[model samples]
Target chain A: MATYKLKTPISEEDTRKLKVNDIIYITGTIITARDAAHRRALEFHREKKKLPVNLQGLAVFHCGPIVKKENDKWIVVAAGPTTSTRMDLFEDEFIKNFKIRVVIGKGGMGKKTTKAMKQYGAVYGAFTGGAAVLAAKAIKNVKSVEWYDLGMPEALWVLEVEEFGPLTVAIDAHGNNLFEDVQKKVEESRQKIYQKLGV
Target chain B: MEENILINEKIVDDVAVKLLQLAVTELPRDVKEALQRAYREEESEAGKTQLKAILDNMELAEKTRTPMCQDTGVIIFYVKAGAQAKGLDKIGYALRSATRRATKEVPLRPNAVDPFTQKNTGDNTGRFVPFIHWEIVPGDSVEITVMPKGGGSENVCVLGMISPGQGVKGLKKFVVDTVINAGAKPCPPNILGVAVGGGADIAMKLAKAALLRPLDEPNPNPDLAKLEKELYEAANSTGIGPMGLGGKITVLGVKVEYAHRHPASYPVAVAFQCWAARRASARISSDGKVEYLTHKVT
Candidate 1:
């Protein structure tokens, strides 16, 4: 339950120190990416094509924001984390290729992602799922955006943020995953519940 | 011998916007109270933290008049139509116009996407969107309720047709299994709506409609009320807790709705509503007097 404030371009060593249940607040750059964004990023990696922006040493937020153009600038209205499990298929490859240090999202990722975190040095931070406005308060600017053709939710949104979190490290660099841990206990309890219900 | 006010497109459009505003920006009183209770009863630090953040987020959204969650979700309108109400033909156009207006004015995220093209409609409306369900009732007042169905929760809704021999035990097991399999994905602590004994479509429709029930209201049928209580306890006992981090509250409540079966077919549908649980309703009389049913709006 230790708390930390970290800036972007975080080193592998820094991510390695994070443990399950540790609280972290990140300041600096984070990009919003969901299902389509992940597919495109991986497609580009396979083709050896350069992406519009380099994501190395940064945080990737699983979010689809409500944004509007006001006076020729983008204003982020609500930018909360989407369910991270939706991106589980792409996460392993995305981490290996992009070298992102922090992954902020809700729910949690899968075994592939946990193994990747241990190998490449990354942590999964769980923000409260429905707290969109609070999440938006930390965002200071839309640094830039790319792949608008993918639509807002699936587009790549580069954002500059302040101390933007209260994120719990649900998966850490050492292969400890809070979600998997909970799932195991839930299975054990379900057996007992089934016995009682006579199902 | 009766005095009735004429209903028109203008009034319908204006009222729809007000309903949309309240639906996205304000959580209902019953839901807020349930979350507060979960916060007080939560045992683990992770559960406590999640509930606290949710409560704080509600206050912020209400104060700032912004959306509580980014999804804002797909717009759904439930209409209880009055047979005697005028301008029934204008309701569709007014509601569609209202959806477009709210997308820009309420700044609601345009979430409607065409599955074939994989392109967003950008205004949250397309073919059959802002999907309306109409029920004719014996009254002179038209009531409209709006529920924004988010992708996370909607993605997990399930339907199962089981052998009639399995009966109640099998039905209950299916629900608990659904909750376990859903895990943290639907963003538990969830409010579950379950429908039994209808056709697949009917069961799903009834299940979603059941979610409009306030948390404090139990089913009038004593047997159904008992079933809801048992399921609610079973879900909370699993320790999925808030955000599924393992604690004392996996579900805030369970709501069950059912139709008499076809003797051989037993269809069960589970509708999952995340902890946000947002909806608002309004009733308009023939004389055009509007009353906000869910929230106290000025």
Candidate 2:
């Protein structure tokens, strides 16, 4: 597995070739958002209004993490990725609207997302679902947080991250899905097991 | 014999918040060790990679005292109250208050809402902030277990009622089929909790309650325990593996709980827990004392 330190303004070519086990050390501007943020962003876009943040070469993570303040600074407790499927409804639109280059989440995105990635020069990265603590380590700083009224954890916290991954390239620019590929293999194995059991 | 046992509302709230904090910050010892073992034994390269990442996350959460996942989950409190206990409503109020405080303090995700309006109260409290399920038995003290049920695994829960003719074999087939159909939707190497008997609602509740039991802990009934073992073996044999990648271990554990049912109805409910299996519990006494019950970690 190849390893690369990714930064904003990343080219589609570099991200497209990323493999399943490749470890990525992402730096630059990464935004933390989940179901609510995505929905709001889409609503704003529909109204032809400026979004809360710019999307170009940006990485949007599917997370609504818990945070605590110590000495007046916010610290991530468990920032593990949530399931990405829930965001599937708006991902393609968000990707195209924002010029987002990398999407970090768990599970896998759908066909529209894959097509959008290929067409728009983006890549989908899969962070481990329950690995919030590990993901927090990659977060070097919280640049700012919008919707503080949404509470410390659920608020959309803009983060400046560094060396952030070990994230899998589940959906490469070419539309190959590691999750689906692996799942197919598993089904085959299951069939073999059933055969052995003669059930 | 009239027994005197009364718990204060504040005490209930305090305990709930503490439980929520622990659920997010601390990786139970048994859970941590099991993930480590899974990491070592996982043959699939991808599965091993995922397992290692989870372990790293656990380490980070503990060291930093941050939550292990962004989806802190809905707070589910399973309370078994002693028949002698007074002021049960106080316990409910405490749970609710604790949920509100934890939303701000523990920084839990705002999970509760108005079912129709689709509005998020943002404090993780609205109608039914702390979903409380109560069981009153003839006893002296109150025992409560808190499970932070995440959306991913909760979505995978299934319920069905079969005729008596279907039997245990039919149940096995249904369970396997459900997991296979679930694929990676609920996340894999999951803990499958099955509740048999009772009516539809009761069966489902029991399924969730079954999840409160520690991983690898056998059921009280030998027959049920044997069934759990069989299910666990069969689930893994499905080759669903970790994260649904092909591997030897599909399910980490299987737990089954049962109650007597009506003659014609055989109700079944399956609750799936992701690899994280985030949960914790505490026992409270009438004298306002508490004992935090830590589950076997790994």
Candidate 3:
């Protein structure tokens, strides 16, 4: 239930203090990447090649943003978080290879991701899924755009952000899950509703 | 009254493109205001924080003329064509074309594809471009509504066929249980649309169509209206609150629609909508004139 405002390039100490279900308001640098970028990064790892971006102490946001450019400058239209579960397959390898400290998206990640967070001193934050326009306002600058062939919206656009989130800590370094907690509460409430209705 | 209606084929494409662009670029004024109000009244510190982020995102989208979310969703068009209108087939093609253009112009995510091959069609159209649903009515005006339903809430939709003996009370319990069980997965403070009666498939479609009704509109059936209120109250009682972070309001509202059914069947479908709820509509006359329809965009 504790709260903290995190600036990116987070430290092991900062990550350690964050427990599951805690609320975090994040600011600073975070990169956006989805399935394609994840796959490419893994392929690079498999080939033992030099990685594209420096991964140290960085947070990777799972997103595909709608962006437009004016005078060669790219601006985000709506950059909301995509479902995190899609990344469950490659997350462990991505985290381990990049030394990623925070992973932000929606819903819950799987066991492999949880283990990776615990081992790599990382945490997963769940931003509201449909609130893309809301999430995009936090970006102050588009530092770079990679994977242009993926199109403007789906491309991997590195962004500089400020006061970027009020993200829920879905998974923490301790391997706790807010999604599991809510699911349990939901079951309890379902039972109560059934009892009240005499069904 | 054998009136010949001249349907302007381009009207359909224009409407579809406008709807897709507006769905992302504009956060309707009323929706923005309501969300802001919710943010002010939200009691959970966490909930309020999430609300603020949403509000900020709305502002950014409006200022930059960007869409509200990355999952721009499948473009669904509900068209009520006047029976007198000619060229209905052309309108359908227009819709498909508009969806393709918007896919690039609005920079909508390439959400459409071959299910088996997992290959993106690139234009956002294929088997059912724009996912058009049509109803021919006896009128001189063509009405079209566009709704971009996101994956998160769409995944949470469910259908059940309760026995006739279960009645409306059972309907209420089922709806509450569905929402409660959904938890944070569907992204609460959601809008729940319930469809009663009809067969399984029709019930689900009716439930989705019910979402097109205004958020504040009362159910046409008095009994169903009462059930809507009750389910709303019971859902909030779960303390699922906004974003399921815990608080007073789990659902913003519940809308119910019913269709006549068989003697023994009582089909029910629940469609949950995330807070974004991006939808818009337009009405076109046989003479090619058009008027914007207001639902979410008041």
Highest lDDT among the candidates is held by which one?
1
Scored against the native two-chain complex, candidate 1 gets a DockQ of 0.73
Which regions of candidate 2 fall more than 4 Å away from where they truly are?
A33-56, A65-78, A86-99, A116-121, A144-158, A189-199, B1-8, B86-89, B286-288, B295-298
In order, the B-chain TM-scores come to 0.98, 0.92, 0.92
| Alpha carbon deviation, residue B231, candidate 1 (Å) | 0.2
**What's the TM for model 3?**
0.86
Q: Write the per-residue lDDT of candidate 1 for residues A56-161, one digit (tens) a residue.
A: 9899999988888899999998988887888999999999999999999988998999999999999999999989998898999999999999987789999999
Task: Compute each candidate's TM-score over C-alphas.
Answer: 0.94, 0.85, 0.86
**Descending-TM-score candidate ranking:** 1, 3, 2
Q: Per-residue alpha-carbon lDDT of model 3 for B6-47, expressed as tens digits?
A: 455566777778878887666555456667777877787656
TM-score of chain A of each: 0.95, 0.91, 0.92
Model 1 per-residue lDDT tens digits across residues B65-133: 999988888999999989988777788788999999998899788889999998889999999999999
lDDT of 2 by residue, B1-298 (tens): 4444455677777778888888877756666666777788888766777787777777777667677777778888888998887788688778887888988886777888788998788777677667888889886678877788878888889998876787776677667777787777676778888988998998988888887677757888898888898888778776666766446667777889888999999988999988778877888887777888874322
CAPRI category for model 3: medium
Please report how far candidate 2 places residue A40 from its true position, in Å.
7.7
RMSD of each: 2.1, 3.9, 3.5
Rank by DockQ (best first): 1, 3, 2
Better of 2 and 3 by DockQ: 3
**Alpha carbon lDDT of residue B212, candidate 3?**
76
